[model samples]
Target chain A: MKETITLKIKDLFEDIGNQATFVGSFFRNIFRNGFEWNELIRQCYLIGLKSLNIVLITGFVLGFVLTLQSLPTLQQFGAEGYVPNMVSISIFREIGPVITSLICAGKIASGIGAELGSMKVTEQIDAMDVSGANPIQYLVVTRILACTFMVPLLVLFADAVSLLGGYVGTSTAGGMTAALYFSKSFSSLVFSDFFPAFIKSIFFGFTIGFVGCYKGFKANKGTESVGIAANSAVVAASVWIIILDAVAVQLTSIFVYNQ
Target chain B: MENVIEIENLKKSFNGSEVLKGISLTVKKGENLVVLGKSGQGKSVTIQCVVGMIEPDEGSIKVLNKEINELDEQELKDIRGRIGFLFQHAALYDSMTVRENLAFPLKRVLKVKDEAEIEQRSVEALEAVGLADAIDKMPSDLSGGQRKRMGLARTLIVKPEIILYDEPTTGLDTITSKEISRLILSIREKYKASSIIITHDMSCARITADRIVIMNDGKCIAEGTYEQLENSSDTFINSFFKI
Candidate 1:
């Protein structure tokens, strides 16, 4: 039992050390000369463009459901006029970014993990490495940067779509006009509310990309490891997103909202 | 003849289990030096160390007069540019077309920005491997033999001085294996490349080997011409040559 516990602790430390080294390499390569702009653009198109429909759909459902769920409680208190305000603040400040990032963790993170894991297993990454090409620069940096750049745009897009959904939900319940609903929604959001959430989304994006790439790149040699990488990427990214969201919420409440 | 690769007392261990136990070998310029070994004997590990993919725990690996372990990243990359490594699985970039696959090393390693030059080299390399018609096809679309040929085309595109093939024929039919062996010989004659081919295929050794080194238990057990090794009275060495 003692030996098993010791081995587990050692493995944990090793994983942490590996992650630290991977992050170091990422930073070193990101600023290196000959940045792969073309590949970055391709990844952006893949990660952002490919993920649009799903993000939109999820965002819309979240806003619609939140508004519907909160309607009766607000109605009981004779505050039906605040439905739009409630939905918008909830979506933009927390729900929009967190839910969108979770969605991205599922879609983008898993995709990168599986792709890179497959590449590693098939020796394609090693081929790139031995061919005098910087696999870290060409593969890891571009994917991470694309994720970092695209995830925020995706969150913003999801936020907008969710507001539209909120408006639709309000209209279906015969609560407000389209123009009135949108105006109320936008009115409730301030700089502090939006900025903190946006910044958190960026962190969430980085976590997703970093975790996914790290898991995939370090995958053990086997066909099964590809699936393991993909699965673990999603799990790790999701956990990191939640943890980051909690920390961001605390920091935002302390600094932004307190002021 | 010049020694392009010299590995002396090379040692590597994974999880305290020693894989390569002080392996020593050399490959001369424009020669096909085949390392014959059964599975799990660290044959692949040796060549991987030569290319500096896996670092050695002890001793030295010198490719083209440069010590592999001593070089920095850029210097290692420079060494790697001069040394082509063809992996066992062919390692064709699955996301790329055959044309793009051939052009990868040319663009990345050679830094050939000229589109026409890239195009010409890609076609020429593919033509050399008889894969000219599969240019636009994805690696997934190619047969196993075609994939190996495509891999060789990619390796040759950079025009490296030394080529290290890790099981150039692992999972092909008998005919395809012979064809690949012949292709290895043709490549040496055409490109004047020094190669270290790691394989257990006796027929491939017979066809492509200028000198053969049989490895077992992480050490080279015997080194000689195929005929010399074939005539050895030792049961262990004769077992390889026997029917």
Candidate 2:
């Protein structure tokens, strides 16, 4: 039993090391001459534009529900006026970044993982390598950059929609106006609230792309491994998203909150 | 260059198991050398080394008078650009139209900026393989034989100096296999390209090979014309030729 535990621990570390090396390759190939612009634009369209409606709907519903849930609880203590402050702080600091990132981990990570996993199994990657084309540059770097840039943009879009939802939820009690709701929301938000979330979203974006690409590219050699790669990518990316969020919150707490 | 490729005492092992053991072979300019071996032997590994896909742990491979391992990254890419590798599966990018697939190497390796030139060469390449009608179709739409032909056309689009064919006719019906073999023969003559054809397909060897080398147990066990090899007295070699 002890030996088996040691082997499993060793395997996990080796897997992490392999993924780090894969990321290192992504950076190394970025400096090579042939940048794949068309592929990058296509990935941006697929990852960012296509995901817009879904992220918007999810974000709005999340914010609306959080406000409704918090209203009755805070009303019991005569803190109804603090609802906007509560919504703004919660959405910007934690809910917006974490929920949007998890959504992306489910959607884009699985797509990239399955696509590259199938390519690897069919020998298309080897064909590219032997034909003197840079598969790492054409496929991995383009997709990673697309996700890294676009996911942050998606999170910002989601935040706007969510804040609107919060205002709508606030008006349901028949007392506040849109101008008042937004003003109160903005009044409570400082730079620290947005900045930490923005930083976390960037880290989440990198995690999603890196984990997806690594799982897909280094998948075991078989047709079934394609399915395994896509499933594992979603699971791994989701977990990493939360893990990084926790680390970001801790860092934000230690540095800013303490000061 | 008298010898387009020269592999000297090449060896390779994977996970402590040796696949190729001190194998050496040569292919002269414009000569087609077919390597005949059983399924699990290292015939494919040897040709893969010639292209620098598999690093030979113990020896050296020279293509066009330059050592493969000695070349830097750009040099390796340049050398690979000058040499074509036809994988067994044809490996046409399924996402791409046949036309786009053919044009890929030209755009990336040759860096041909003129679209007209790219299209013309692509059309010409398809025409050479009689796959012009497949120009707009996806690779998934192609028959196995058609895919192989398209693969050959993609390789020929670059007009490589040497080509490495890894089991070009493995899964085809016998007639289609022979047709592919003859196409390989004609393409060789037309391009004036040296080639290393790796196969278990005897009919393919008979049609495409200018000379034949037989590999077994990770070594070249016999070498001669196809007819000379067929008449050999060695029992292990004869087992392959026996009808």
Candidate 3:
């Protein structure tokens, strides 16, 4: 048991090192000549347009539920008018970034993992390498950058959808106008709330890209391992998203809220 | 004959098991050298090292008179740019149409900007392998022999002086295998290119080999013309010829 535990720890450290090297290579190759513009556009389209429906539905439902759950409890103190403010602050500040990231963690990360994993298993990567093409430039750099840019855009879109859902939920629960609800929502949010959330979402995007690419790039030589890589990418990306959210919140509290 | 590829004491080990134990061989210019070996005999590893795909633990690989291990990254890329490797599975990029796949390395590595030239070259490559009709078809849409032929077309696009065939006919039927073997011979004749064809397919060897090297226990055990090996006094070498 002791030896097994030691081996597991060793493997963990090795995997982390491999991922750090992979990220370093990604950055190095990003500036390399012959960027795959067509591939990048295709990826952005896939990541953004394909993920739109899920992000929209989830964000809307979560916002509605949050409003419903917070309404009656706050009605005890007759703070019903502040419901929009509270819900908006929560949505823009923390909930929007975290929930959208987790959703992407489930969808985009797994897609990248499975796609690249199958490529690796099928010797497509090897073919690229031997063909003297820059596989890293064509594959990893385009993917990581696509996620880093697209996920944040998805979050911003999701936040808007969720705000709309919040207005609908609040008006149905008691009574509120769209103009007044939206006004209160913005009134409660300052630059501090918005900027930090945006920063966190960007980090969440980075995490998803990093974990997904790492799992897929280093996939073992089997079809079964491709499935494992995809599953592990989602699991790993979700865990990292949560961890990054916590760190972002703590840092935001220290730097923004305190000041 | 001028040597195109020279491997000296090439060795590689995986998880402490030596796969290529001091393999030394050479392929001459415009000569088709086939390395015949059973599975796990390090035949693939040997060719893979020539292209600098797998690094040898201890030894040197010189291709076109340049030492692979000594070349820097860009130099390595420049060297590899001139060599075409067809994977055992053909390994066509599935996301690409056959034309796009052929044009990929041309545009990316060779930096071909003229669309007309790229299209012309891609179509010509397909024509060489008799796969021109399959240009717009995806790799998954093709049959096994067609895929292998398409793979040959993709590799031939770059006009490589040296071609590496890694089990080019491993999974195909005998008829298809013979066609691919004939293609390999025609490719060499038309291009005047040296090639290292790695395979255990005896018919492929009989069809394409100018010289044959039989590998066992990670080293070249015997080498001769096909007929020479076919009538060898050595029982072990003769066993491989026994249907």
Candidate 4:
């Protein structure tokens, strides 16, 4: 039993080492290939363009629901006018980034994972290598770069849409005009709220893309591995986003309070 | 004949378990060498090692008369441009049209500047593999045999000096396998390119191989002409043939 335990520990260390090596090589390939502009543009369209509608609808619904749910509470306190400020802070600081990332973790991560995972199972990656193509450069880098750029844009769009929904909800509550709501929301949103959320999203993008690409690239065995990789990509990305968000929040609170 | 690829005493291991143990072989510039092996043999590993996909722990692999194991990743990328591969499944990109699939390596690796030239080559490659009409179709729309042929077309678009076929006839019906074999033969004849085919199909080996290398237990067990292997009284060889 002791020997078995020792062997398991050794195996775990070896696996971690192997993973580190693989990730190191992947990053090296990314630098070596530089950036592929055309591929990046193509992927941006896929990740950003195709995802706009879903992000918009989800963001709007989230904002509207937040406003409606908070209405009863704020009205009871005779602070219904604080609705716009509250909604804006909540959407921009937390809801916008978190919800957008979750949606993206579902959409883009799964898309990338499934696409690359299928390619892997079908041996297209091997085909690329044999054809003198750098599969990592061609596939992984394009995707990671795409998500890195597109996710921010998606977050931006989602924030705008959600704010609009917040305006509609406030107007329906019979106390705020669109103009007044915009002014209140904009005034309440300091750089502290926007920048931290925006910065956290970049990390979220990186995690989503990295985990998705990593799962798919390392996928072995057979076709079943593709499905497993896709599923794991979503799960891993979602978890990483939440973890990163927590770290970001702690870091932001320290810095903001100090300032 | 010029030796395009030479492997000497190659060894590989996965998780400390040896897969290719002291395997060695060579392919002349225009010769088609079919590597015959059962499912778990290291046939695929042999080709991957030659291409530097997996590093061998021991021995020398010289491709195009250069020590492949010694080359940097950039150098390996350059070498990869000169070789093509057909995977077991027709590993086509589901997102791209057949035309785009053929054009992918051409544009990315070859850096073909002229769009017209890229298109012309893609069309020609599609024609070569008998996938001319499926240019606009997605890979998902194609039948299995058509998908395989499309894969062959993508391989040919690069005009590689050597083609590595990994289970080229696996999962195909008998008719499709025959067609693929015929396509492989014609491809060899047309381009005069050397090829290393990994397959368990005896008929494919007989039809396409100039020299046959049989692997068992992670080692090369026999190397001979088709007739020589067939006439051998060795139990393993005889039983393999009977099967």
Candidate 5:
């Protein structure tokens, strides 16, 4: 048992070494092959445009629920009119980026993982290498670049939709006027609230694409490895997003508070 | 005959479980060399090392007169243009139509910008492999044999100087195996490419090999013409051929 544990550790180290080497090679190929603009556009369409409805629906629902749930507490304070401001701040700074990223982690991360995992399992990756194609540039770069660009667009869309949902929820449940609620919401949101969340999302996008591509590209063993790679891709990306978000929030609070 | 590929003292290990250990071999240009080995005897690793896919810990691999181990990424990419590999399983991209699969490397690697030229070459390759009608079909729509043929079409589309076959007959019916063997020979004749075929299928080795190399325990145990191997008195060789 002890020997088995030691062997496992050794294996893990070797895998880490291989992954480091591959990442270096992956970046090298990305630069060597330059960029494929059409492929980037296609991936943006797939990752961003195709995923808009889910992000919109989920964000709207989340905003509506948060407003509805906050009504009772704000009513107790006799500051129910402040509900929009609170919901807006929460959504813009924390809920919006975090929730949207979790959704994307599930959607885009799994898609990238499964696509590349299947490619690996099928040996299309090997075929690419043999055909003098840099599979990393052709596969991983398109994906990572797509996620980097698309996630920001998706988050921007989601934030807008969610704020609109907040407006509807406050007017209906809290008996606040739509114009007054939106005015309050906008007044409460400064550049500080918006920029930090937006910046964190780029990290979220990078994390999702990086972990997903890493899992899938390094997949080996057989068909079952594809499933494992996809699952771990989602899990790891989601967890990293949350961890990074916390750190970003802390850093933002420090800088903003002093200013 | 000038050597197209040369390996000297190759060694590789995954987690200390060595796959290829101090192995050496060479293949001449235009020669079809069949590497016969059991399933886990490092045959695939040997070929992968030659292509610089799995880097060996020790020793040297020279392909087309260039040291593969020392080449930079761009250099490797340039070297790769001259070699082709037909995977054991067809390995066709599930999302791509057969035509796209054949054209992918042409456009991506070869930087062939003209759509008409890409299409023409794709069709020619498909025609060569008897897969012209399957061009628009997805890989998932093809039969196993058809998938393998499409894989061959994709490999041939590049017009490589060297072709590597990994278990070309492993999953095919005998009839399909014969067809694949014929395809291999036809590819050789058409391109005059140096070929390295790895398989345990004795019939495949017999039909495709100009010279047969037998690997055991990560080492080249014996090598000769197919008839020479078949007639050898060595116990392992005798048992291998079952004659």
Candidate 6:
């Protein structure tokens, strides 16, 4: 048992090292000549456009539930009018970006993992390599960049959707007008709240892309490895997303909120 | 004839088991040299080492006069650019259509930016393999023979000086296999590219081999012309012919 535990820890550290090297290769390939612009555009469309529906639905439901849950508590303090301010701040500062990122971690990461894994198993990657084409430049760098660019945009869109949901939640009881709700939502949300969340969502996106690509790129030669790669990509990306969120929150509290 | 590939005492191992044990071989310019062996005998490993895909544990591999193991990444890419490898399963990029697949190596490796030239070359390559009508279809839509032909087309598009085929007719019907074997001979005549074909198919060897190397237990056990090996009095080599 002790030896097994030690070997597991060694494997964990080795995997982290391998991932660091992969990310380094990604940066190097980004600056290489003949960057694959067309592939990047296609990946962006696939990752961003295909994920929009889920982001919208989830964001709206989250805001609606938060508003409904917080209403009675705020009513006890006769602070019902502050519901918009609370919901808006919560959605923008934490909930919107985190939830959307987790959803993308589930959807986009697994899709990339499975696709690349199958390609690896089928010898397509080997074919590309032997043909003198840069697989890292064409495959890994494009998908990661697309995810990094698209996730923030998705979060911003989700933020707006959630605000609309919050308004609907407010109307379920005796409520303010749309104009008043919009005004209240923006009144308390300063630049600091929005900027930090946007920045962290970008990191979350990178994590999702990096973990997925790394897993898929290093997939072993088998049909079983494809499923393993996809499942592990989601699990690893989600864990990284949560860890990054915690770190971002702590850093934001120290630097932005304190001042 | 000038040798396009020269391997001396090549050796390779995986997980403590040696796959290629000091295997030595060569392919002459414009000759179809077939490496015949059963599975796991490192026939594929030999050509893979020649292409710099798998590094041999020992021995020197010289492809077109450059040492494969000694080349840097850029130099290796340069060497690889002049070599076409057709994997066993055809290894088509499933994401792209047949035309796109042929155009890919041309665009990326050859840097052919002219769209018209790309289209012409892609169409010509497909036509050569009798797959021109399959241009717009995806790889998954192709039949087994069509996929292999499409794979050959993609390899031919770059106009490499050397082609390596790994089990090109493993999973095809006998008629399709014969067709592919004939295509291999025609490709050599038309393109003037030397080839190292890895296979266990006796019919494929009889049809295409200008010279044949038989490998067993990770070593080259016999080398001769098809008729010479076929008429050999040695029991082991005669056993291969009997099959």
Best by DockQ: 1
Off by over 4 Å in 6: none
Model 3: docking quality category: high
- Tens digit per residue, CA lDDT, model 5, B15-55: 88988888889999899999987779999999988888888
User: Between prediction 4 and prediction 6, which has the larger lDDT?
Assistant: 6
Candidate 2 — which residues are off by over 4 angstroms?
A1-10, A172-175
C-alpha RMSD for every candidate: 1.0, 1.8, 1.0, 2.5, 2.4, 1.1
For every prediction, compared with the true complex, DockQ reads 0.92, 0.79, 0.84, 0.70, 0.70, 0.89
Which residues of candidate 5, in runs, are more than 4 Å off? A1-30
Ranking by DockQ: 1, 6, 3, 2, 5, 4
Off by over 4 Å in 3: none
State the lDDT of candidate 4 residue by residue for B1-243, as single tens digits.
889999999999988898888998999999999998788788998998888888899999999988999998778889888888787887787778998898888888898879899989999998998888999999989998999899999988888899999999998888889899989999999988899999888888888989998999888989989999988999898766785
Q: Which run of 10 residues does model 1 chain A get worst, by summed lDDT?
A: A166-175
What is the alpha-carbon RMSD of candidate 2 to the true structure?
1.8
Clash pairs, candidate 5, are none
Clashing pairs in 6: none
Kindly list the per-residue Cα lDDT of model 2 for residues A47-72, writing each as its tens digit. 99998888999999987888889999
In the predicted model 4, the residue pairs found to clash are: A132-B80, A132-B81
Chain B TM-scores of the candidates:
0.99, 0.98, 0.99, 0.98, 0.98, 0.98
Model 5, position A132, has a per-residue lDDT of: 77
lDDT of 6 by residue, A160-252 (tens): 999999999999877889999999999989999899999999999998888889889888999999999999999999999999999999999
* TM-scores of the models, in the order given: 0.99, 0.96, 0.98, 0.92, 0.93, 0.98
TM-score of chain A of each: 0.98, 0.96, 0.97, 0.93, 0.93, 0.98
The runs of at least 3 residues in candidate 1 whose Cα sits more than 4 Å from the true structure, single-residue gaps closed, are none
Worst 10 residues of 6 chain A by lDDT: A167-176
- Fnat across every predicted model, in order: 0.95, 0.71, 0.76, 0.83, 0.81, 0.81
Looking at model 2 chain B, report the run of 10 residues with the lowest lDDT sum: B47-56
Using TM-score as the measure, name the better of candidate 2 and candidate 4.
Answer: 2
**B43-97 in candidate 2: lDDT tens per residue?**
8889888888888899989999999989988899999999999999998899999
- How far off is each candidate at the interface, as Cα RMSD in Å? 0.6, 0.7, 0.7, 1.7, 1.3, 0.5
| Per-residue lDDT of candidate 1, residues B183-238 (tens digit) | 99999999999999999889999999999999999999999999999999988988
